[model samples]
Target: MSVRARTAIGAVIGATLLAVLPGCGGGTSTGDSGGNSHPKTLTYWASNQGASLEDDKAKLTPELQAFEKQTGITVKLEVVPWSDLLNRILGATSSGQGPDVLNIGNTWSASLQTTGALLPFDDQTFAKIGGKGRFQESALASTGASGKTPTAVPLYSLAYGLYYNKKMFADAGISKPPATWDELVQDGRRLTTGGRYGLAVEGANVSENVHHAFVFAKQHGADFFDASGNPTFTSPGAVEGVKQYVDFIARDKIAAAGNAEYDQNQSIQDFATGKAAMLLWQAAGPNLQKHGMKPDQYGVAPVPVQSGTPGPGQNIDSMVAGINMAVFKNSQNLDGALKFVQFMTSDAEQKKLNGAYGSIPPVKTAAQDPAFSNPELTVLRNTIATSAAPLPQVPKESQFEELVGGAIKDLLADAAAGRPVTTQSVQQRLAKAQQQM
Candidate 1:
């Protein structure tokens, strides 16, 4: 997914009661024709995955050209920014007019699947794109609601990791990276001096807020949803978990107060500029490269845990983060769209695209590249494989991002304003968020 990124949402779209929705294609369907005649063109909405909108367009042109050359189908691509993506998809669902294929944040899969607007990637549909076996298992976990057909196919796979400036660590006389939260706070004190903070955070960024909240909540042994799938946002564990994250600036002071206003990747920029000694991000290699930070200047490690080394249960460190490709059920060029999906997910494209973006490929075969063994990427891979967990996949999960994430934003702002953030206050804010849900 740095600069792989989130937020929550309340259900905004109601399933349209019109013509019956199309079915997933048959076992041998070669891009089933949606209209009277086979289609020749497709409109694709690609998520912004590169340095900028223009950059993503430039990076994807070659792949699009190649796909066109072999398949005789033209793809019209629109690189949409993250801020507008979910709303745009919701708009498409309500209007029934949108691009044939689109990239969705993997976390939105379940919520969007409920709209009945996107085509379900059933067994047969997955076969069209080299089978479900081609993708990583962890990457597949957040595709849709549990125990149902996946609504999308994993595209770029990612997991969060702690990225620390080597020079800062060495300068501070700190040896190894922190393995626990206590050590991190201790090291942070040493690193925070001379106008630089020990850590960086994206406070106003709701998506990232929800992400860290989810990770912290997991570490506190809290789940946003109960066993029966009801939201339990104000639970004691949930409140404590969320408060711990805000405390980076609120109480710990490891991050600067100004960080409370940062969104739009400023936290990443702060780390790259040496204004912050460390960063927690998903596949930040590309973002750092954009800022001209050399690979050797920093080292990657698993995010610090509350207690012991990262593992399952309360030790989980990061949420599975990445993009997924979903075909719109109402596409006029269903066959062409499927072909594009196949072209994009093919082993070659997976390697080329993921390499350019500095992300892990969801396709298993594509990950065998020797390049993935780089020290920075190796840490990310291990975290994703062993410690990363997915956020709740319920329909209201997006709403949680909106409500609770916004609450954190306010809390951080309050901290920046020198207001006291007590446990009672944190619980009150969380209770308000739960009431909204």
Candidate 2:
């Protein structure tokens, strides 16, 4: 899932891939494996989703223990902090020493798969876990390069929504949330009074900025990569999409001048503290509660579609987002590792794990449980299936993120500093960014 912490994909691109380890017990498998030759211990690296590592361990250890009892394979669990997880993964990938099974942010799948370090999940391997039909199609499609065998499987699912402050809407004499891009800007203007802004945007956090750029681009009928998997940031539709995003601060003046420095967490804070009327984010309910905002004070809605865009409004929101699990190719216990993956993606475990993290499970049946059937989660779950798109699946996805994200960051800084943000200027910046890639 998209966490509050900033992710570093650059490190992975810079590191060299590790050579395959020899003498590994499990090379490849058919539908299923004969039991391991002897009792085996599996090391698992989990991401920290709770307030602390202790809290995450508290929620996950019981599940791990249950897996051990059911399968007779011991699990060594390590809860890695988000700040350190990427570096650790890169380090392990280079050293050929890492956990048998690990959690990775879905956005990093393509980049990590490029290293030839992860075990690919082919048809037979997928059957070992469960039928591929059990997963949400879009979520499954997000596991790796399109048309190739995926290196991971969706564990938890998440999507972006427009979060609006109900009280602010009422006070501003607005009755409902915006349904189109124009309405969103107009509503933002109406809400801009006193010290509060109509909207909040994360300008400093490159990853967050790039995500918004992707949603807006899709809304305008643009894809970041062509059929041949080449970068297309300079496309007319893509430029228009990003221009509209930057206009929130430059032309509309509904966002604060200093929002250029805000990250996802800061934008969340702005909305929670009533400094902004609306915010675009993904599954921010848990964070809202932590920031002292009551559930009743806010509402969630699908992100507004661009005016005059064709087709239904299902494809104009955030990417089908969340974390996925991958098995290391260099692990000495590939059979046991695959079994652990099966155990983790089981209906029972998906429900338990996603429920603890406040995300929807990837399994359709597990996602349908009453626990996630609430209105808030239902909106995002539907978005994931119908509206969400995957980040570009190129091996150089990290480079795309860095180059595009940096350009947007520069644009935001210029706008925040009261500099010009004309369409021509935006296109020029984007063109420069494309060249860098």
Reference-based TM-score of each model: 0.94, 0.90
The deviation in Å at residue 253 for candidate 1 is 0.6
Q: Where does the lowest 10-residue lDDT sum fall in candidate 2?
A: 23-32
Q: Which residue pairs in model 2 clash with each other?
A: 1-323
Q: At residue 22, what lDDT does model 1 achieve? A: 35
The lDDT of model 1 is 0.83
What is the lDDT of every predicted structure here?
0.83, 0.80
RMSD of each: 3.6, 4.0
lDDT of 1 by residue, 265-306 (tens): 899899999999999888888889889899999999999999
Off by over 4 Å in 1: 1-3, 6-38
User: Can you write out model 2's per-residue Cα lDDT over 1-437, one digit (the tens) per residue?
Assistant: 35444543353443333332332222222112443433368888888776568988999999999988988888888898776777677666665667778988788788778767788899889998987888888788779988789989998888888899999999999999998888998999999999999998888777787888988888778877898888899898889888889989988999998888875378888999999999988788887888999989999988778764223343567777788999987666778888999988999999998887778888888988999977678878877877788888777776677788878889989999999998898889889978876
